[model samples]
Target: MFKTIKNDLPASIVVFFVALPLCLGIALASGAPLFSGLIAGIIGGIVVGSLSGSKIGVSGPAAGLAAIVLTAIGTLGGYQNFLVAVVLGGIIQLLFGVLRAGVIGYYFPSSVIKGMLTGIGIIIILKQIPHFFGYDANPEGDFAFFQVDGENTFSDLFKTLKYITPGSALIGIMGLGILILWEKVLTKKAKIFKLIQGPLVAVVVGIIFYAITKSNDTLAIAQSHLVTVPIPEDTSSFFAQFSFPNFSVITKPEIWIVAFTIALVASLETLLCVEATDKLDPHKNVTPTNRELLAQGTGNILSGLIGGLPITQVIVRSSANIQSGGVSKMSAIIHGFFLLISVIVIPKLLNMIPLSVLAAILLVVGYKLAKPKLFKQMYDLGWKQSVPFTVTVLGIVFIDLLYGIGLGLGVGIIVILLKSYQNSHFLHIEDKSNGKHKIKMSFAEEVTFFNKGAILKELDSLPRDTYLELNLMNTRYLDNDVIEILEDFAVKAKERHIDIKLVSKRGVVENPESFIEFFRTRPKSNLSLS
Candidate 1:
């Protein structure tokens, strides 16, 4: 970890800048205290990082849980009650780790995962637009179809256009331009810009701009565009920010429901991040899924206990970690430590950073995740991959993240089934021997119920008086449905004066008496020939 630190410190700084605003934004979206998000970020980085087996993955407060947290708070009666659910959710995730359910992440198709990332990228860009324009009526990270204010996503964007504040918009544009310039040109120039990070520079410029405009009341940006950190007047007031759960409510069924909701969503998000971070890792390190779950579980438990939002291994933070040159877990740990120190020691200075400047930084991060090249690459993979990928992307953009992924996974499974059905069997015809046409039907490996229709159709199409050879030597498993169809075809073959040969591990039979009974003689595996 120390060796990794020397090489990754620069990247860590960049990740720190990238993570700071997102932590606050997610907290705001969850309707929890702003510091709660920072707390999660710190714990996710420091605590989870130390426990995680992943070399490159970074953990943080995720946007995906914002809606769940918001509703859970209300449903559970208060934020403290929601903390109980989060802690329980963490315990549930730990159980998942112990049960080795982490392999579930590997089963998802690559197309669907890509779609998820793209979808999330688009959502980030969309959600940040309002912040860029200084119309922050909704919280900084809300991305649901319907918002707490009763307006839908598109409606909020349209509403923002009509009420754009000049100072905020101008500063936002300037910040974005500076970010772009830094990435495209300044960062490449070692003499002048190597020592300074673009996001840090953009933030400093925004603060200066805000201070300059403050004197001219007409040109001033509203408080909405500025970063809002709760300023406690004294040590006692700061400590009072921590909330405790009413454990008496734990008996209520609603608490269990909320706990399950958090567990499910948090687990899914963590799994997805594990897969994504594996992809992003320069060394192509495979993170142990179960270990990741355990790490996340521990982080969430700590976060909940400390009045923080639930923690997940977030792709956004992980991607930033990778891009920032993080090679080991130390960078993640340091970033978390940075979050803790920033809030405790210099929160006022943190609040001086403009929301628009942060939006600019995220815009860059979003583009990296959903680059046009990714779309082109997926398109080249053909419709089987591209269709699901596009569907997931659009679903995430128009709907929600989980919905989009579910839709994509459904489509991907259908495509797999279709391909399997297409390749399940092959027919060959040879010259007639002794005045009968020789028909050969070769079955594929592992024939399941999905191939029943196609196999039956092929058998039914054979001509009368044909000499048929039904091969099951290559087939490992024949589902009961296909076995039944084969048995029915055998009776029809005899009636049609067709000669049928059944080939299996056992000697060939002229005409099987009973398909199920013949196969019963042998050990019952996936495949049995009567």
Candidate 2:
């Protein structure tokens, strides 16, 4: 882990900057104690980071769960009650890991995955625009289309025009300029620039700008437009931030329902991040998905016990880690330590960093993710890939993260079925074999119920008094549904005076007695018949 400190250390700093406001913002949005977000972020970075197999993915309190957390907090009676649900959710996630439900991430289409990344990128840009211009009515981490602020994503843009702060906007613009110059020019000029990182420099400069202009009225940044780390005065006050879950509430059926909801949503989000971040990793490391759920489960459990929001593998932080040149999980762990140390040592100092400056940093991150080239790239892949990709993007922008993915996934399934229906079988005809029309139909490697219609259509259209060769030599999986279709066709073939010959890797059969009976001797998935 220490081997890549040169790369990981600077990368961790960038992730720390990216994570700070997000923690506070998501906490505020969730209607939980602001400190709870920090606790979750710290645990996510430290505990989940240590346990997870992912080298690049970062975990934290997610904006995606803000609505659920808010509602559960009210419905479950109180914040303390919600903590019980969080703990139970962690346990449920652990079971999901044990059951290997992490494989669900793998089944998502590549188009949908790419769309997710691009969609998130677009959202970051849209969500941060108001913050960048010094209009921060909505919390920084609220990624949903309809916000707790009672405004939608686009409405906030107009609101920004009404309430823009001059000083905050100035620093934000400068910060963005510095980031662009550092990344595009300064980093190439010297080693020190890369070591310091652009986002860290932008944040420091924003703080300095905030400090110097404090006395100026028109140019002064407002308290609302700055990072708001809880400033605990004494040691006891600092420790007082932690809250324990009320285990007595665990008996409530409502608690169990909330727990299951958190478990399912958090686990799904984590698995998606695992897949997305792996795609972003320059090293191309494959994260062990099941282990990730276990890590997340453990992190959530610990976080809930110590007064924290539920945790998930967060793509924004993970992508920031990767883009900042993180080489291993050490970066994530180091960032967690940074959060822990900052909240303890310099909460006031952190509070001085203008939110707009962080918005600038995120703007760049967002641009990198939603670059114009990806749209055309997806489009070039054709509608089969592009349709779901487009749908996912639109859904994310107009709806929310999970809903967008669900919509895209639904479209993706339809595309798959269409492909399956078309590619189920191949046909060839040998002219006049023994004065009969001789035709050969070869099934695809894996024929399922989706192919039932196509296979039946082909068989029904076959001329009477014909010789049919049913080839399964290359097939590996034949669904029971398709087998039944073939069996019924075989019985009808005798009356049509069509000679049926079945050929497979096992052996040839002429007028087979029962296709079902034949495959019954094989394994459940019919692997042995292949």
**Worst lDDT window (10 residues) for model 1?**
521-530
Model 2 residue runs over 4 Å out of place are 432-436, 494-497, 506-530
The collision pairs in model 2 are: none
Off by over 4 Å in 1: 191-195, 432-435, 514-518, 525-530
Per residue, candidate 1 scores C-alpha lDDT tens digits across 1-39 of 787666466666767777887788888888898889888
lDDT of 2 by residue, 34-109 (tens): 9999999999999999999999999999999999999999998899999999999999999999999999999999
Judged by whole-model lDDT over C-alpha atoms, candidate 2 comes out at 0.93
Model 2 poorest ten-residue lDDT run: 511-520
> Candidate 2, 188: how far from true, in Å?
0.8
| RMSD score of candidate 1 (Å) | 2.2
- lDDT, candidate 1, residue 102? 94
Backbone clash total, candidate 2: 0
